[model samples]
Target: MSEVIIRDDLEAMAESGLLSDYNRRRLTAARPTDGAMLALNINLTAICNLGCTYCFAKGGDYGRITGKLNEGADVESILQFVKQNAARGETVRFEFFGGEPMINFSTIEALCWRSEALGAEQGIRFLYRISTNLTMRLTERELELFARFRFTVSVSIDGSEATHDRNRPNKAGRGSFRAILDNCYKVRERSDDITLVARMTYVPHPDSSLVADVEALYAFNIFDWFQILPATVSRELVRTVFADAFGDLAYSEICRLCADKVDSEYKLLGEIYMLLFRPGNRFRGVLEIETVIRMLLEGEVANGHCSGGRNYFTFSPDHSIMPCHRLVGEAEFRVGAFGGTIDGEAVAPWRLGINDTPVCRDCAIRYICGGGCKQENFVATADINRPDPEKCRFQFRLVHCAIQAIAESDAAFRARRRGVLRDLFVSCGRPTLSSGRSEEVPAPDRLTHLIPLLHAFD
Candidate 1:
């Protein structure tokens, strides 16, 4: 694994007033008051066809007994919930999620049509997105509905065939790579209007190579964008499946193993940096890299880890509501029900900004890191406010890479690619200077000094 050198100079710059001008402004920026875009992750079913090794949802049932959403009552409750929360002319995003949401395709169809009708009546615009494995064949009607709704399809395929097959196998222990690929092509052939995102999960195994996996996936040239995320494996989940293999292993050891996987991301970062030089490079903007770059370019900082527990809430198949989809099985995270009132106090902790976390407040890259993922933090440390040290190290490295990319890129290159880069950022759901600002704000002068320190990594 690559090591990040936390130089004293960089720490000093953050602690003192040198970097505070920009950092403080970002730290103090008001959080969005009125929730403009309310994202509701409707967990259609707890049942999935595939049994992933690192499945946090515990074989698609979220560690609970198998259950699926009721197309009738559940659909009605969801629509009612939206009506209560959203205002007229406001946009409500229904993100179809599950073990494999395709298991409840009927529910999806019903909800989409019903929600569209409701939107028309109430003057509320509704948007749709689905996170599916793409192992199932979609009917002509399903394809038409997706194309008409312009649904953003996030397909969960882990890079290459070898990696994907190993990480995600069917219940019968068979490879699903071929089926998923065929379905991907089918969906792509259906419509150019639908946005297809290749969501790759990086599992830390001895045989796994992140760079090779990404290259194989990119070669297909089927996806419009790529979202790569590290697999979050809890000790309980590991013990449940591989107790005999990991019986004597400590939780700390498992965390160490996963933390080491950050090196793969570091390697991929180098690939992304190189792609910047290639004109019309489709693979240049990975979601992770583009997010940091977007923040740097727009002078924006995250008030929290994500919209979870705030505007973003997950509705489980059992009618329970949780702060995040990852915390679906946990009872403590449950703040409300489908048609019940949400407990504001229960969700407040997740609303904490980066400046609010004591551990993150002193970090050099606190503003950029946004205290890491709250769910990851809660899983690792059993506390939402505290962050995993290794995760913190990874964030620091990522932020440094973003700074290096901006500092090293020539003015001519930046000027030529500014428009393209802006579009990439916006597509990733981040607002740029075009949102309100008339002119782009130049990065702080102190950022230049860190470029020399960043060279140590090279």
Candidate 2:
């Protein structure tokens, strides 16, 4: 198991302004659902070129709907929905999704332009994002659009060739690792400012460990940000639907592996940045703990994981709407349909906050955790309204590991060992000064130049 140094002085550190109210408030205040719809995920198509074993959508599988799209009225309705939400003074983000989103590139190009024009006229900011397998070659025009629009692209690739190709293969059953890596390089070459996040779905193969998987991502060298999700498949679903591919890999088994190795994962992350020359890029495997500490410092409580229907919703290619991208397929989960009326009754159940969940009401760390992910709840309990015990343990472990990091960082900063604090805070995009100023310290480049003497301590 990985180890994170835990200090018992978090309360004292908070009192000493090691945690600033200004920074904490600034973070928690930017809640996705402050007033209106925060994000809309538009699935342009269900047909992906690569067939990943853990795909929640079952992209190429015949059992699920694929290659569907919104026609004239449905398209108009989606646009109107965004415009209406933006009119309410909310900054709305539109995410492009797919079996592979690039498969429907033409539609995405058109939609991006349309959204930008609307945002310009209405004084609304439009943020664009895409989650793709990155197997196709990107055109010059596509790269130019990404640069011009400041797109945040999340490329889904598992770590290492053997591990990645075993789970994620193209329709022809060949490895996609090479093409995806090449595309990532092309993206970096095209734009330096664009945020490239590498998202990995970890499968507990008999030969690999989580630490090794994370190291594989770092070896790629292009991704500045990373998101890691354990491959989650319900026991019944695996047996009935994807028996050949997933076999007996259960979500609980995955959770147990992670819980046992939490400390090992923590230590790896603490030392990970030392392996690279650059100081800016970050791995977010358990990065949410920083946010949890910020929320704790501010003395605030939050709803469960996501506000779902209230803050964000997914508009599928067929014009059906669900709470999020993860809940795309089930008919019972559909809350509304574009070009049609929204059923408030259907959405009401989803809007239930973390406070509404019975189990979470008494939990000590509910403020940081919210409840658990809604999709995982549905998978474990067979009821979207219920919380999953397996996922609860996983979420709790993340919060616990995060608390450990905060304690260590704060203790080190007060002891004049700000170098370690600087490294940890670099991932947060800004460093909290031990000098107790409400304002943030300067950028890493500016601070690094001023701190040549600090390296003597190192």
TM-score of every prediction relative to native: 0.83, 0.76
RMSD of 2: 8.2
CA lDDT scores, all candidates in order: 0.70, 0.60
Model 2 ranges off by over 4 Å:
1-37, 60-62, 70-72, 236-290, 297-300, 410-458
Model 1 regions lying over 4 Å from their true place: 1-36, 237-251, 276-284, 407-458
- Number of the top TM-score candidate: 1
Output the worst ten-in-a-row residue range by lDDT, candidate 1: 429-438
Please, what are the lDDT tens digits per residue for candidate 1 over residues 276-320? Answer: 445443444566655666565544555555667767788887789
Summarize candidate 2's per-residue lDDT along 288-387 as a digit string, tens digits. Answer: 4444444333233343366576667788866688876777877887888885655778877765644556786566555456566767777778777677
Angstrom error of the Cα, residue 202, model 1: value is 0.7
For model 2, state the Cα shift of residue 316 in Å: 1.3
